[model samples]
Target: MKITEQEVHSVAEIARLELTQEEGQKITHALQVILEQTEALKRLEISKVKPTVYVLPLQNVFSEDQLDKCLTQEQALGNAPEVEKGCFKVPRII
Candidate 1:
């Protein structure tokens, strides 16, 4: 697709940007070059290639889940300096 200076101006207006004539022309040319470069990529053969979220194989690295013995609430708060209504009490922040 060919990019035009008018298109650049339109985009600039939408972005609330004030581009000089030179900057607009430069941006238009740059966009045109980018589009032209992408044209070569359009010729790649991918008929047999399946679309994927990842380009490489991915696997879970996490360990297996298992139930184990845990401390009770009374044991957990056994060493607390302050405990109020079965909860730890911290200094109030201003």
Candidate 2:
């Protein structure tokens, strides 16, 4: 689980990153710790445990969509900055 400076440098090169000597050393140590922790976790026995996407039960909190009254075209365009042909006029985007 030990991470080497060479490995850190290789990853940095692949990611197009320019790491300083100190940064590379720090990253190497951090990666070593993470890998060690992951190795420790892999030792756990979870054969009897059921797989779950979430720890807690979840339910939809939103109300069902329903048809509702809509504003008239004139009412909808009343506050528009600019209107043309009974619709909002937007700047051309080509």
Q: What are the Cα lDDT values of the candidates? A: 0.91, 0.91
Model 2, 25-78: lDDT tens per residue?
A: 999998888898899867899888888888778867686699889999999999
Task: Please state the error at residue 3 of candidate 2 in Å.
Answer: 1.2
Off by over 4 Å in 2: 47-94
Clashes of each: 0, 0
Q: What is the lDDT, from 0 to 100, of the residue 54 in candidate 1?
A: 81
lDDT of 1 by residue, 1-94 (tens): 8888998999999999999999999889989999999999779998888888887787776866888889898998999999999899899969
In order of appearance, the predictions have TM-scores of 0.50, 0.48
**Residue clash pairs of candidate 2:** none
Q: What C-alpha root-mean-square deviation, in Å, does candidate 2 show against the real structure? A: 9.1
